[model samples]
Target: MATSTNGAPSMFSKSNYTWMLIGAVVIALGMFLMSGGKSADPNVFNRDAVYSTTRITVAPIIIFIGLAIEIYAIFKRSSPEKK
Candidate 1:
């Protein structure tokens, strides 16, 4: 639904920007998940907290998903504006 009136075509549509925003939010959520795992005592290390499935496995997956979304956003082509 976006065609530049002038000769040049717009690089991205509103939909593309929306997807990019979603992707960025997903990435931030993944980072937030990875950032946690603080132990109560600094000296004593809690292996479980450090190696939890959410941090090691899930977060990276989430981040990758976000990256994929970002890639999609970048590559997505705008549909031709209907008459």
Candidate 2:
């Protein structure tokens, strides 16, 4: 059995970390999309801006997809490559 210099195996491979990073970026993007629906005027209310499809529908779907990717990344098994 192979072991590191400290005699402990790494919990995650490089690819796993990459996937996790990608998932995190996706989640951030989703959150960003959900934002920016505010009206410039304090007294004026814009229903369309607040209820836009991108913010109300697309953003939530993107967030859910990102969460799913993160979950998959956490459970994914890494197989060592043969040299």
Candidate 3:
């Protein structure tokens, strides 16, 4: 009997999907941080610390968006041409 080698294509694979999601989340976080400007709180711990932490939290969102774009491009490339 012949063994089946069928499997999901790279774009649709679990690993790829997970990575894409992670990337999107990263990018989103980055955007959030950049847009946050600086913490406006007058008495919450430290202003700079809060601002910096917010900025750091945003890095992932940027990364995630890039990954998602890449995945979209890959899928587009693999799609069959319409007759």
For model 2, how does the per-residue alpha-carbon lDDT over 1-83 read when each residue is reduced to its tens digit?
A: 23457978877777777888988999999999999977889899899999999999999999998898888887888887566
Per-residue CA lDDT of candidate 1, range 1-83, in tens? 57567967778898899999999999999999999778888999999999999999999999999999999998998888778
lDDT of 3 by residue, 22-62 (tens): 65766666666666444466555665664665456555556
Worst lDDT 10-window in candidate 2:
1-10
- Give candidate 2 regions above 4 Å deviation: 1-5, 81-83
Best by TM-score: 2
Q: What does candidate 1 score on TM?
A: 0.85
Q: Between 1 and 2, whose lDDT is larger?
A: 1
Score candidate 2 by lDDT: 0.85
In model 3, what is the error at residue 58, expressed in angstroms?
Answer: 8.4
Q: Candidate 2 vs candidate 3: which has greater lDDT? A: 2
Which of the predicted structures, 1 or 3, would earn the higher TM-score when compared with the native? 1
Q: What lDDT does model 1 reach?
A: 0.92
